[model samples]
Structures are given as structure tokens and as C-alpha cells.
Target: MSYVLGIDIGTYESKGVLVDRNGKLVAQSAVPHKLEIPHRGWAEHDAEATWWHDFKQLSKSLIHMARMNYGISADEIEAVGVSSIAPAVLPIDRDGTPLRKAILYGVDTRAEREIAALNEAIGEERVFEIGGQSLSSQAAGPKMKWIKHHEPEVYEKTYKFLCGSGYLVYKLTGQCVIDRYTAVNYAPLFDIHTLEWNDESVSHMTEADKLPALTWSTDIVGTVTRQAAEQTGLAPGTRVIAGTADAMSEAISIGAIHQGDLMMMYGSSTFFILTTDRIMKTKELWPNVHIVPGANTLTGGTATAGSLTRWFVDQCLGRDMGSGEASNWSVQQAYTYMSEQAGLSPPGSNGLITLPFFSGERTPVHDASAKGMMFGLSLNHTTADMYRSLLEGISFSIRHNLDVMQELGASVKRIVSVGGGVKNELWLQSVSDICQVRQAIPEITVGAAYGNAYICGMALGWHDNLEEIDEWVNIIRHIEPGVNDREVYERHYAIYHRLYERTKDLMKDL
Candidate 1:
């Protein structure tokens, strides 16, 4: 049987999966990696140590599992595709070696100064027209400018700049190229209409030619090199496609391809929604290239979702959880325990609501100064109550993001949830109840890796198109909002919405 390998380098971990032509997962493996924060509001990853190392380890292990456990050979692996966190900026030398650490998506704030400077120079109107969205710290253009201004020595030594997926593609195929979705985020530097780098945008910067060539996500870039074959245990000459941002890949995996279908990726951060049809330009959300060619639209959300819960678990609960522990008790034991304990309290965690802006926030409120806050904390509430409130707060933030999309005339009827957060059924149900939207969970939650496999199949002619992918993408379960719970959540959501506003001024002082 022919097999396809999909590898995804996520913010918190790296995952790889082997899937057959029939879209059935045969084997899977993952390795955890750490995110480094040298300073507050700054997030960086050791591109060589964390990303490339985990990619090699996960891919090799998955290949070994397929051979030893499933009796599949390397030759049977027709193609290999990869996906990773979007908007990561990594500068590399001519041979594709990372010059320094990588600045991660939505989390890293080293570019905040640059964002302000660029916004002042190129007004929001010009940025929206050329860049397709208001400039945020998440944009690659400012991040690149940050390096140029702040670290002039490192900037001068750099030869090329690439995202996480592009870096992996370069490691595999010895070619540095970025997909349109990833490249578009580099705007004011890339023209969305022409699909090429805008010379005028980078005229002030030096060595602008260092940007990687752009390609569609599914386009074949190059074959696996000998070094990659040895490192990843794949056959030399294997095809490697130009991969996509994690959000677009997750959308593909969950069958959120058609117009109006939205994929809410609840992972390290929560990406709220994806719509196929384009809407009027708005500063609150991002409008960019869709994974599927010719499908223009909007995608936006909070920068912190599951990451908030994770912080509560690690810093607050102080529990050591193992990776891939998906058993009922193991997967959601912490959340379930906390929710049960908080249920005995009352709605709004007894007047306490967490802002969950630990990593700053995207969507609705684009304030980088926004800090996490716990409102109405008195002598009455326990730590468990605070934890539950954090979960609800994150869910409430998602609802606010969705509301913004709706207010901007985007139709969001159904949502498909995919990522690490989906492993916790209690959280999924809580989000559905709070958002008042039907949520569907896929049988497989391998996320962007599985999505990349589906894209590989389509590129190799195993499937017709994205619609066929939806037909083949299986749904294991669906979570509908309970009438009573939905009503209760609506009342609490009103309070949740107020918490952000009430605390916004104080957060700015922080």
C-alpha cells in the first residue's frame, strides 16, 4: 500500500503521522520541544535544536514504526509534506543554516517597536491595501525590520529569511521556498495581487533578495536530499511539497474547505475561524490567501487559548503530564477535576474571570500591552476555581473573536475543532456551550500533519479535490451546546466580555 508522511512542527511539540492512500492513519509519533522566553513578552525557538532536531527525530521514528510495526517500506511513502506554526521569522545563511534563534508567531514581541515604527511610516490604510491587514507584531515585515534595526550585526550576516515550514522544506530539499499563505503574512513585503515580493516595500532594507521564493502550499518544490534522507530515514529523491501554515493545514484536516465552514484550532494558541469568501477589510481580523488556490477569505483569533490552560496546569496545578496520554482520565483529568470542583461554586468562577492574555492577544483587541488578569478575586475562591475561570475566560475570548467576524458580515454557522485542546472533551463542550455554536471533533486529532497528508494525496492525484477530502475526512463525534448550559453560559459570557473592558486600562499600566 502506498503511504504518505505528514510532519508538523507545532509551537509546543513536533508530530508526524503515516497515512495510507485511503486516508487511514497507519502509524504516528511525536516529540515534545520547549519554547524559550529570554525576556517577558518575547518567545523564541532554537530553530536548529528544537525545530529541526524534533523534525528529524519524529520523522525517523514514524518511519521506523511504519517499517517495523506496519511492514511498510520507505519506497511506499509516495510523498512527504510538512506544516508548522505560521509567521515565524528565522534568518539563515546561504546553505540554510539558521543564523540565530527563530521568532515565533503571535507570541514573540521583539518586533513591537518595529510594528509601531512601520505603522507610523506606512499608515494603516496603505498597510491594509498592500499588506491586506493592519500591521501586528505577527507580521514578518516588521520582525525582519526589527532584526535590521536592533541586531544590525546579525542582520548583516543573514543571507535569507524563512518561516518554520520553509525552513523544514529547505532542510529536506536543499531549497528555500515559502508558501503563499506564509509569504502573504510578510506583507507590505509581498504583494497579494501579484503574489511576489514588493520591491518598494523592502527598498529601505538591505539584502531584500534573501527572501525565499514563493509557491503554493501543494506545489512540489524539490526532492529529498541525501542529508535529509539520512536524518529523516526517508528515501532519497522522495517528493517534498511546499507546505502551509498550521491554521490552513488544520482547516484542511477538519474538512473546513467549503465557503462558510470555519475551523477553530485550539492548540498552543487559539485560531478562531476561517471563511472561504472574502469580506470587507477590517482591522480586527486578518484577510489573507487561503490554502486552496482561488479561495480568498478571512482568518483571525486570539493568540492564547490552550496555552492559557497549559500555564494553569504547569504553573498553577504543578502536575507532570505525559505526551500522548489520551485515556479519558489521563487526557482531561486535570480539567475535569477542576471543572467538577468549580461546578460546585457558581457561574463566572464566583465573580472571578481571567483575561488569559499571557502571550498578548490577537483579534478584537490587538493590544500587546494587554496582560493576563484575574478579576474579582476575593478571600472566597480556591485555586481550582481560578483554574476553571481561566478555561471559561479563554472560551469567552474566542466567542468575542467570533462575534467580531460575525459583525464584519462573515457567516459562521458550524465550527470544527482540531488540536491539542480537543483532547479534553470537557473543554470542547465548554467552548461550544459558551460560544453557542455546534462543534464537530474528528476521529483523528493529529492536526496539521494529517492535513498535510491529505494535501499530499490531492497533489499526487489520489483524490480529486478538497471536497473529496471532506468526504474522506471522518468525524468521530459532535458536541452540540446544551440548551440549559447555553443559556447559563450566555449570561456568564456577558460578564466575561465585561471583564476585558474593565481590566483593559489596568493591563495597559502593567
Candidate 2:
């Protein structure tokens, strides 16, 4: 049977999956990598070492598994698609070698100064008017400007600035190109209305022509390079489609295609929602290009989601619990233990609330100085109690974003949870209880990788459109808020909302 390959380069790992035309997974493989935080607010990745290496390893492994385990051949693969974290900035030389390490997604804040400078030059209102989004350290334009102004030597030799997926696409197709959703994050640099790079914004750059060509996420950018084919164990001339940001791909995978459909991605960092219909602009929320063509509206919330639980285990409990070793008590074990502990604690973690701004905050707060806090902490509380509160706090923060989206007229009827965090049933239930929204969990939790497969299927004419893609995705589980827990959560949510207000000033001092 003919199959397609979908690869996703994520913040902490890279994954690739092979799926048949019937949407059955033929093979899958993943390679984990480290994230570099050289400075408090800076997150970097050695593009060659972390992203490309993992991509090569995972892609080869997946292909190997397909051939060895699933009896699928390289020639049977019709197309390949890729997706990755959005808004990363990686400057590459003319030969496609990375000039410096890649600046990661919104989590990295080294471009704070550039963000302010851009806002000043363009005027904040004009920026919002033109790009439909506000400038953050997350925006690619500011990050590119930071490199030009701060790292003159590196910036001078740069031939093109590419994101995670763009870099992968370059390795595969020998062409540097980016999809609209990822390119739009270069706001004020990209014209959202026209879906093209802004000429005036380019004039601000020292080497403006270095940017990659823009295309739709589904557009066939080029054929696989012979080098890439050898490294990835794929056949020569395999078609490569321009893919999109991970969140957009995840949304597509879960049938979040039309207006009002919401996708809640619970990964290392949570992305709350994305909708198609436009809402009145708000300073507190992000508005960007949707992955689907002609869909102008996109909204999201960002903060510690699964990462909070990870922090608690690695930093707080790992050493003491004898789980400090790489192989001992995996993240899965820690999550399972935490979930069990959360079940022991009552809703709201017995009135102890946590602000999961460990890596700083995003969405409504947008404060880089925002530090995590555990309010009403007492000597009586255990690590389990703190962990439960942390999970709930993250959920409350998501509800806060939901409230803001509602205020801005984005209708969220249902939330489809996609990612690793969904594996924790307790956390998933708590989120549903806190948000008071029905949660649908897909049979496969591969998320963006699966979404990329769906897009590739469309590109290869296996499916008619996104709606057909949605029908192929099977829903294996659903979680609805329990009536008793809902009332208790509402009361706790009131206190959860107040915790942010009460601690806002104190966090600034930190």
C-alpha cells in the first residue's frame, strides 16, 4: 500500500511517522534532544546538532521500521511533510550551513530589546493594524533584527533566516521556503492581509534578501535532495510539501478547520486555542495567520503546561527520589506518580494555588519577569499537593485565556486535547473540570506528526479536503467535567484568578 511520511521537529524532540492511505500507522520513531538555555531568557538549539540530527535519525529510523517491521518499501512512500515549533530564527549561510545556533520559539526572550525597538519604529498600533499581531520576543522579525544589531559578524554572513521546519525543508529540498503561518510570525515583516513579505519591513534589515521564499503549507516546494534521501532512507525525487507550525498542524489533525473550532495542544508548553473567525484585536492575546488558506484569524495561549510537571520532578524531586539518572523513573513515571498524587488531593489542591510561570508567562499576562508561586503553602503540604496545585494552576491559566478569547468574541464550544499531557488522565480531567469544556481525545496522540500526514494525504490527492481528513481521524475517548467537581472548581477558579492579581506586583520585584 502507498504511504506518506510526516515528520515533526518539536521543542524537546523530533518525531517521524509513516502512515498508509487508510490512516493506519505503519511505523513511528522519535529522538529526544536537549534544549539550550545559555541565558536566563535565551533558549538556543544547535540547528545541525539538535534539530537536523534528530530529524535525520528519526526519519531514518521510521523508514527502517517501515521496511523491517511493516513490510513497506521506500518506493511506496509518495510524499513527505514536516512541521515544527513556530517562529524560531535560524540564520543559514549560502550553502545552507547554520551561521549560529537557532533561536527557539516564544520561550526564548533574548530579543526583548529588539521587540521594543521595532514597536517604537513601527508604532505599536500600526504593527497591530498591519500584522494583526503584537510584537513579542517570539516574533521572528525582532529576533532577526537582534542578530543584525547584536551579532554583526554572524549576521553579515547569513544568507537566509529559517525556522525549524524551514531548515528541515532546506535539508530535504535544497530550497529555503516557509509556510504562511510560520512566516506571518515575522510580522511587520510579513503582510498578513496579502500573505507576503512586506517590502518596507525588509528595508529595515541589513540583509533583507536573506529571508526564505514564502508558500502555503500544502504547496509542493521541491523534490527530495539525493543527500537528504540517503540520510533519511527515502527514495530519490520524493515530493516534499511546505508544512506549517506545529500548533496549526495539530489543529488540522483534530478537525479544527472551520471557524469556532478550538485546538488545545498540551505539550511542553501549552498552546490554548486557535480559531478561524476573526475577533476584535486585544493586547492580551495573539492574532496570527491560520494554517488554512484564507483563514485570517488565529489565537493562542502559552505557558508552562506539561513542562511544569517536568520541572517538579527534575528540579524538585528527582535528586531526592533517586530518579535523577537519565533512565530511572522516566517522565512518564513521574507524571503517573504525580497524577496519582493529584487524585489523593482534593480539587484546588486544598486551597494551595500555583502560578506556573516557571519559564516566564505568555498570553494574557505576557510578563517575562513572571515567576512561579505557590500561594497558601503550609508545612502540612507534601510534594504531591504542590504538584497537583501546579497542574491545576496551569489549567486555571488556560481558563484565563479562554475567558479572554470569549471576551474577544471567539466562541469555544469544545476543546480537543492533543499531546503528551493527555496521557495523564487525572490532569486531563482536571483541565476539563477547570475549563468546563468537553474534551475529545484522539485515538492517536502523535499530534502535529499526524497532522502533517493529513496534509500530505491532501497534497497527494488521497483526500479531497480538510473535512475528509477530519473524518479519517478517529476519536477514541472523551472526557466531560463531573458535576460535583465543576462546582468545586468554579469556587477554586475564583481564587485562582485572584492569585495572579495578588502576586503580579511581587513577581515584578523578582
lDDT of candidates 1 onward, in order = 0.81, 0.81
Candidate 2 Cα errors over 4 Å, as ranges: 319-324, 486-488
Query: What does candidate 1's lDDT look like per residue over 297-410, in tens digits?
Result: 687868787677766765545544422243323535666665567566655566677778887788778877778878778998888678778888888888888888888778
lDDT string, candidate 2, 1-510, tens digits: 899999898877778889899888888887777778888888888988887888788878888888788688888899999998878999998888999999887788777777788888878998887777787656778888889999999998999999888999999999889998888778668886777888876767545588889988888889888888988888899999999888888888777666677888888888855665563466787777665575655566575786667767776655523233554676566667777877899887877888888777878877776788888899999887888888888888888888888887777766788887888888888888888888888878888888899899888888877778666667888998777777767877897678778877887687
Candidate 1 lDDT score at position 404? 88
How accurate locally is residue 222 in candidate 2, as Cα lDDT from 0 to 100? 92
Best by TM-score: 2
Worst 10 residues of 2 by lDDT: 318-327
